[model samples]
Target: MTDAPALFLGQSDQPETLLLSRANRHGVVAGATGTGKTVTLQIMAQGFSEAGVPVFCADVKGDLSGICMPGSPNEKLLARAQEMGLALTPKAAPTVFWDLYGQKGHPIHTTVSEVGPVLLARMLNLNEVQEGVLSVVFHVADKEGLLLLDLDDLRSMLAYVGENAERIGREVGNVAPTSIAAIQRSILQLEQQGGAAFFGEPALRLEDMLRTSLDGRGQVNVLDATRLMNSPRLYAAFLLWLLSELFEQLPEVGDPDRPRLVFFFDEAHLLFTDAPDALREKVEQVVRLIRSKGVGVYFVTQNPADIPDSVLAQLGNRIQHALRAYTPSEQKGLKAASQSFRPNPAFDTAEAIQGLGVGEALVSTLDEKGAPRVVGRTKIRPPDSRLGPATDAERAQIMAASPVRGLYDTPVDRESAEEVLAARRGEADQAAADAKLAEARARADAAAAKEAEKAAAAREKEQVRLDREAERARAPARRSNRQTPVEALTKSVLRTAGSTLTRELLRGVLGGLKRR
Candidate 1:
């Protein structure tokens, strides 16, 4: 057991240590405020980094930033290390600072698509119905190939789904406008709480956080969550998102010699506080199954009861600092916490929990065969890094020299749901306008055809009038233009009678002339 891989935690009756072989089994660091939980976390982080295991943790109080700076250990710290039979080195771990707002260090970003609907619904605090609607929205986005990169993309997508709810609902499921509006309001609230900066392009790449120094020291990725604590849900959701990312992106190694990465979830209660049952189950499931991926998750909270029993059962290694039990509820919690550990039989575990001084904890970790060792009253080791936040100038210098210095610092606005939906709407509008113009042209054509018909009819009528006047001009003038057959015969007989009378008169006149 002497040469076995392990992290020296501190001195108990014997040397207290956490076997690195079982580090992937997951653990917890629980204590009240100012009970050396941060220090314990720092020591564990440094230990893992030294083992070439990358670490990710939130800087809630801004104190974890000191891991990037060398410590100025006081005499007391040095004496404690010597008493523990160890020579201490005050050197900083290789650390890279991160911030969601992009003010502290490298900006940590993730697409809305990556956040997905479930975690997003939890983040937005949506009810069941609203969450279902959100799931439908995600489905539609996926089907339509819309990339939801940021808040605007999500907002526009919601509007699109809301406007086309019936059609979309028939294809998928019911997307209530009220539910959509509620989710929208929740998004607005999240945006107001500064969540807009988190969902965008140039998202955080897991490889960057999982990097190790060229010298084989693990890189410590510290997220500046001091201001983020103002919105506890955001802080919790982000860390959980990172954990989920690690679980999904990393292949299952099935209990590697050491964890590929170590995640320290600070202020863990916010993850479960008012969280829905489904969400809690999701968190529990992730914690349970993510160990096979060789990533260790350590929850840092004020009390063990803050974690649901289902989740609490999964944490094997426990470093519980002192917890006060002034109230009955507190005492009940204390009893429950103490009973969770294997009884040492040296002293009452419950009594030892309350009587423990600062930097003192009941250390229990899994043995080489993956079994919880008996609890030990132990003095936790001091961190080799500084005990407080790093100076602003020092942080700036580190960030300037960061490996991912320029990668995620600037924001990227590529084409996504926002622009896609907008262009679709614009096209729709142009189509409508063209249709109206076509209808107007059709009406105009009909009017022009009717006018042409009327003009043709008038011209035909005028031509008929002109033909009648030409017929009058070509005809001979007579009082009666019609002829009768009886009148024509009577006129012929009169002409014959008159010719006979003339012939008789001419004969009588010729006879008288001859007699004379």
Candidate 2:
């Protein structure tokens, strides 16, 4: 039994330890500031690494980097170890450092698609309508086969959806322009808050985080969160995305002898603050179900009530440090925290919760049968590594030795939704110009045809007038010939008439005398 590995927490009436097999069931470390919560986390991380389980934790105060360096023997540490009857060793764990800003450690990034629209809307603090619009934008990008790799891709997709809202709304339901505008404003705000550095190609993979050292000890990955904590929403959203990614990618392993990886979330309150009911439910579900995938999640927060009850119920291990009961609300919280633990007969639970010293905590862990053991008042052991932040020179040496240094150091900008939409716009613009040119040529051809028809009509009219003048000139010659013929005939007729008249006169003189 002595050979079986266990995490040495501290002493109750006797020495107490946390079984490594049940670590995947999850746990919580709650305390007020200056209550030694960081030390408890460091000791646990060291234990998990020695058990050959990888550990991932956020470093909010920059102190956690010290875990990568060996500890110095101090009087207080030696006295505590002697009092607790522990053979304490001072040694450093194998560690890999990560930073979102790329200044303190290896840069970690995830594509916008992997972030998805639901978590992104939360990160941007979008309203319901804006969230719906963002979802529609993602839908459009997916349907069009556009890859959303970064912030620029998302922004371009938003613009494209807004410009074609009316057309797209017909097929994919209503997309309001006002909603699109609001989402755009939110994205711009996120960009200004260093969101651009978070979303891009060569995203982080879960395998990289689960690596073991050459000596068979697990690597402790410390995420530098000093700058990231400034943007609380971004920090929360990123952690949530990482959890969901692990849940989705890892296969079911049931309960193993030890977890494949252990994740510790610091400043855990931001994960639930202002989160919608749907998001909260999803988080709870992930916490409940991720255990089967051989991953344990530990939440480090200032208050016990910060975690939702559904999630808190899944935590099998509880290490609660001191809580200040100065105000009425704090006293009530103190009472609630006291009632949660399985009672210890040695002391009052409520009084112990408020009176626990800096390194003391009310600890309860799962037994071999998966039941909560009796609570014990424990003095947490100091970490085997340094208890403060690592120097810049030390951090630089660690990053230089990392195998993934070259993989994520240089950012890649592959073809994505932004480029695809720009090409589409270019093609559409060219098609419009071609149509306009064809319309103009048609108008010019019609005008030219009308002018030619008018010219042909005028030439035909001139020909008719010239023919009439020629006919008039020929009419005179015809008239002269006819007149000569008519005059000869008339003269002949007059001479015949004169001769007949002479005869008639002779006869008519005698007839006239008779008639008179």
Candidate 3:
């Protein structure tokens, strides 16, 4: 077997922390402040990176920058190195930077819709009723094939479904208007906390995070979450989305010699605090099942009590750092942390937890035979990477070179809910406007025809009046004077013309009525 401390974990004396190639299915790292917890995490991450297993870790503090460059060789560092028995060689490992805020690292992004309602409800710390309503909105979106690609899309969709709850319920089934309304209101509150940025395209692909360089070094994916940690809801929601995505997307690989992706979750307490029972159960289930997919999840926290019993039990490999017990609660937390490990006869674990020096941890891990190793206090190896932040120019250069820059740098609005909904609304408005115009035109035509008919009747009346006056004048003249041939012809012509005019006017009136 190889004597490399990176692969074999702790030595035979400290067999408890000695993890075999196969036993690192998944695990947790817990300790208090000033403990070597962060360093322990660094060691594991670097080890996994060396093993050609892609490692992803969240950098809560600014100090994890050391992982980006090799540590400087100093006498104090060399002394600590000898105590750990690691070769005094400083070296750097492959690393990639990621961030939620565009300022820190490569912008790590995801759409709110991809996160879905199940996980969002958990993140928002929604009540049961609120969650139920959120589910209805999601159901409406899903039934209609509305892609919830970002937060805005979801917000717009929720507003739509809420406003038309009855209609949606009839068409798609069970969209409670009350629930919809509540969800809409909750969404606004969520938006206030920078939820808009979290939900949109330019989303990170799962493949990009799990990658290896051409030189055979595993890529160390670092999440720059200095600001995101402030919002526990978003952070927790994102973690769940990430975990579930891996579980669902990745195929089962059974037990592999090494993990395909090693995920490091910092500030692990936020994940379980006040988490809904349903959400907690789901998380527990994913943790148990994800190991077979060649994924290793390592949680980083100051206190072991921060993790739930159910989750704590699934962590096969463990690294225990020192804890300072200043308060009653802290003392209780420390005692519980020590009890999590297998009892070792070498020293009192409870006493040792308080006495361990920097870079030294009470370690325990799985042996080559897949058994628990004896817990022992051992010095940790120093990382080859620089323990300082990278320059802006260097960071910018690295991001520029990343293959994922062009891939996820652009946003895709797509033909999702926004487009489909807008089209439907546009069509309805156009139809309404067309109907109004048709009605207005019909009224205008009716009024114009009535005026024409009135004019025609009036003209016919005037013609009859003029003919009566002429006949009266002729009768008087014919009666008073001698009979004349011209007068007689005039009377006969007038009679014939009167009958034709009367008939023709009546027919025109009938035709006008029919047309109307």
Model 3 over residues 1-516: C-alpha lDDT tens digits? 335334534333543233425544677787777666776777677777777888888878767757766778678877756665667556666777887666667766777667877788876667787777677777778878888777667777877887787787786566666666666677777677666666777777899888888877788888877788877778887887898899999999887767788888899898888888888898899888998888888888888798888988888777877788999999999889888878789789999989877766777777666666667776666666665666767677777877676675555677777777878889998999999999898899898889889999999999999999988888744455765999899989999999999999999999999999
Error of model 3, residue 422, in angstroms: 1.2
Q: For candidate 1, give the lDDT of residue 169.
A: 88
| lDDT tens digits, residue span 414-444, model 2 | 8899898888899999999999999999999
lDDT of 1 by residue, 119-165 (tens): 89888988889989999989999999999999999999999999999
Off by over 4 Å in 2: 1-3, 448-516
Give the clashing pairs for model 1: none
Tell me each candidate's TM-score: 0.89, 0.88, 0.86
Q: Top lDDT: which candidate number? A: 1
Clashes of 2: 0
Q: Which ten residues in a row have the lowest lDDT in candidate 2?
A: 476-485
Better of 2 and 3 by lDDT: 2
Off by over 4 Å in 3: 1-20, 170-181, 477-516
- Please state the error at residue 37 of candidate 3 in Å: 2.0
